[model samples]
Target: MSLLTTKEIMEIIPHRQPMLLIDTIEELEPGKRGVGKKCVSYNEPYFAGHFPGEPVMPGVLTIEALAQVGAVVILSCPQFKGKTAYFAAINNARFKQKILPGDVVMLEVEMIKQKGPIGIGKATATVDGKVAVSAELTFAIG
Candidate 1:
């Protein structure tokens, strides 16, 4: 069972369908950490033109998914309730492998630093234990 479903996540964050990349949040620590999951599908809209014959999930989307999970961590706080977590910056992002359809992306993000409304999180997305992408994400809670 999921710790938080898509409906529950929507209550915390503003993301909706076509943009809500995470299907389930398997684990979470209100304001410190979160582990989410995204099951990539062949029917994803991006697969149409991301490549004609070869469909690959966009790297930027992968980063966005990570950020969304991070948002859940921050936005779940009572102080941050009804707030939106905006991407302040992305640092040291590395795409290690191509994420394809039928792959399940395991998303993990840990809040490492925070000051006032700004914070940073170390995020990683993996598939079958292999790192697909990782980055240091900065966010501002509004």
Candidate 2:
């Protein structure tokens, strides 16, 4: 029910700079859904060696960001108090575009199901309205 910046997200997820892909979460509905953002930078360490002059965000990183966002949605649920969410699986994941430095990609995730210690979610990454990646991810909370 509120927006969270990386600082707030860090409090919940235990991720930090360099490894923390999400810069801010613009939307949050506890367990139902959430939207997060990642601002790619030209000075990122990866860009220095990602291709010399062409710096494309790694595709796997996008998926990780989405999964982390999805984890936030699940972990933030009131019912999940004192629990930790860990990704267990990923399905039907696809990447369609090249994400570059200076781009602000949006990550959105929707909870599909929650059963006991396991939860499922659908996630998508977009840049300027174009779908860059998507997947169905499952997580476990205990």
CA lDDT of each candidate? Answer: 0.97, 0.86
Candidate 2 lDDT over 69-100, as tens digits, reads: 98788888777765678889989999999899
Best TM-score goes to which candidate? 1
- Please, what are the lDDT tens digits per residue for candidate 1 over residues 17-81? 89999999999998899999999999999999998799999999999999999999999888989
Provide the clash count, candidate 1: 0
Angstrom error of the Cα, residue 13, model 2: value is 0.5
> Candidate 1 local accuracy as lDDT?
0.97
TM-score, per-candidate, Cα-based: 0.99, 0.92
Clashing pairs in 2: none
How high a TM-score does candidate 2 get?
A: 0.92
